[model samples]
Target: MRRLFILLLLVLSCSSKDTLPDITVKDIEGREVKLSDYKGKKTVIYVWSRTCAGHTEDLKKLSRLVNEYPDYRIISYAVAMDIKDVQQSYQQIGIKPNFITLIDPSVKFNDYFPITFLPSTYLFDSKGKLIASYAGLPEHL
Candidate 1:
């Protein structure tokens, strides 16, 4: 019975990561953006928190990648986990990022895309399928 339960749990975990969740989140500009909207094009999403150490550096690196790849849809998802003041956090970092930064106060997609580490990035193909997932700053496009 225990063996069967373990196998079920494993399958459930694998099933959840098989695809990206379709959800709408608001960008810093207050524009409603759907995760599926980036379909038919390659998209890279960076889920980050202001409280993470060395996050400013990671944002700088990601910002550069964004500029380097103008054709690819790059997003910077700012999660509100353990965050007290969002504006103050950015101000303290002093790194003004130039990318499409989205805010998820409730972290609605945390279950689909668990943030195991700071500055986690998820890459999706043109078909909106998850191709890769990284735990730190992505150095390449």
Candidate 2:
């Protein structure tokens, strides 16, 4: 029981903060990207995995949001997945959003962001502060 309490304490302390880790993912063209690249701009970080119908619908929805809100700087990034899978996910779903797609093949994001569910999204405001974070697809369009 004592060990369990300590483990729980560690886990709770690890994930206490909501701010995203300073992680950079690469685009399809192999450009090293940092989260702070677009300072003073809002960013939408989408963490999706590629598989049979895995978060495909959510991607499409986000694509629509990108299209609808062109004025807002929206960046949809694929986390915990490879470039191939990230590209394939878009191709397989036939979704062409007005946002940039990125890759994190080594599942490095999972270490920082506890993304147990697919289609997890993080909304960062103009100051690069994490404004809102959602797990799974948000019902509000």
Candidate 3:
């Protein structure tokens, strides 16, 4: 019975790690928004850094997905030094994202999402459960 209890606890802990936490992050305009607010829609979070090259191309691909998958809540989560850095990067790339863009100065979202690399993509279901994750831009979302 004790071993069964331990196994159940381990399962719960592992499963919880796969779900998106209800944490608050700031938008590009510095407005606070809760990640949980997007729970009802399929979410695609593209994590990138301004210093990382080649993200602009991936961003373009994601832009296409934004229009093709209207039902998906696509977000460009920028882990930059500041909002100005992210803005400058966008200007350099000459592309303004059509999807939602959020800023993470200190990378607090890493605690929940565990971003090991720049320009990573995380796909979550409507219920906030992580469905798939890619280290870099995939050929298709």
User: Each model's C-alpha lDDT?
Assistant: 0.74, 0.69, 0.83
Root-mean-square deviation (CA) per prediction: 5.8, 6.9, 2.9
Q: What's the count of clashing pairs in each model shown?
A: 0, 0, 0
Error of 3 at 42 (Å): 0.5
Q: Which residue ranges in model 2 land beyond 4 Å of their true spot? A: 1-20, 52-54
> What's the TM-score of each model vs. the native?
0.75, 0.73, 0.84
Global fold similarity of model 1 (TM-score): 0.75
Ranking by TM-score: 3, 1, 2
Please list the residue runs of candidate 3 whose C-alpha ends up more than 4 Å from where it truly belongs after superposition. 1-16
- Location of the lowest summed lDDT over 10 successive residues in candidate 1: 81-90
- Residues 4-99 of candidate 3: C-alpha lDDT, one tens digit per residue: 999999898787467777777788788988877777889999899977767989887878988888989999888855788877888888888788
lDDT at residue 30 of model 1 (Cα atoms): 71
